[model samples]
Target: MKATLIQQIEDICNTRGVRLTPQRKRVYELICNSPKASSAYELLDSLRETEPSAKPPTIYRALDFLMEQGFIHRVESTNSYVSCNSCHDKKHFSHLLICDQCGSVIELQDSDLIALLAEHAKQHNFAIHNHVIESHGTCPSCKK
Candidate 1:
């Protein structure tokens, strides 16, 4: 699983023509391994264990690159980031399933749902440059 995620990250960087530096690769690994949304601070803390030399700006720059490449999504409500499961297309954004209790986040890829939301916006004469659906509730584990 880790290998696949790393490959995906490399593929993304290659497809987008972005250079994947070592630091970027490390940050990518951290995001890919996490099951929930993570903040830069959290990632930095974790990276410190394995890479004590990694600095805050290094993680931040790597995160910026990932986000720009559509490899990750930032959850505004919780101020965290999660790898996007949506196909890495510039036109797609993953709908976020957020667990309020534990701050867990799940990425849902629903093309039909996205179309419906777009149609709804058209009905209201609103032009959506970009948008993400976020639903907050307790996840199964949190409920238990």
Candidate 2:
């Protein structure tokens, strides 16, 4: 399953006329392996230890490409990026559940909410292109 995701990312990058370099692969692998969303700085620190020659700009560029290709989703509230499990085309939407106390992030599927949001957008005469909802609160672990 993981390998398939990597291959999909590589295919998407190729379609976008971008080559998937080793550094980008490493960064993508790290994001996929991590259980939580990660910031570029966190990735940079880890990458530096593993590949001392890697620079911050390289990681940032890779991140930008990954984001543009919809290989990852960025959480505005947390200011971090998580690997997008559903990567096929650029026409998908996602909702983010973020824990305020522990900074834990979870992806939720709310079909009803999505429908309502779509209706609301239509009523307001707005063309919905990209949609991201971030709900912040304490997770069960933090509540305990």
| The candidate that achieves the highest TM-score relative to the unseen native structure | 1
Error of 2 at 5 (Å): 2.4
lDDT of 1 by residue, 66-123 (tens): 7887778889888888877753574576778899888889888887988898899899
List the candidate 1 regions with Cα displacement exceeding 4 Å: none
> What TM-score goes with each of the models?
0.88, 0.84
Clashes of each: 0, 0
> How well is each residue in 12-63 modelled by candidate 2, as lDDT tens digits?
7778787888888888888888777888898888888889888879889988
The regions of model 2 sitting more than 4 angstroms off are 11-18
Q: Rate the local accuracy (lDDT) of all candidates.
A: 0.83, 0.82
Residue 45's lDDT within candidate 2 is 84
Q: Given candidate 2, what's the lDDT at residue 37? A: 82
Best lDDT goes to which candidate? Answer: 1
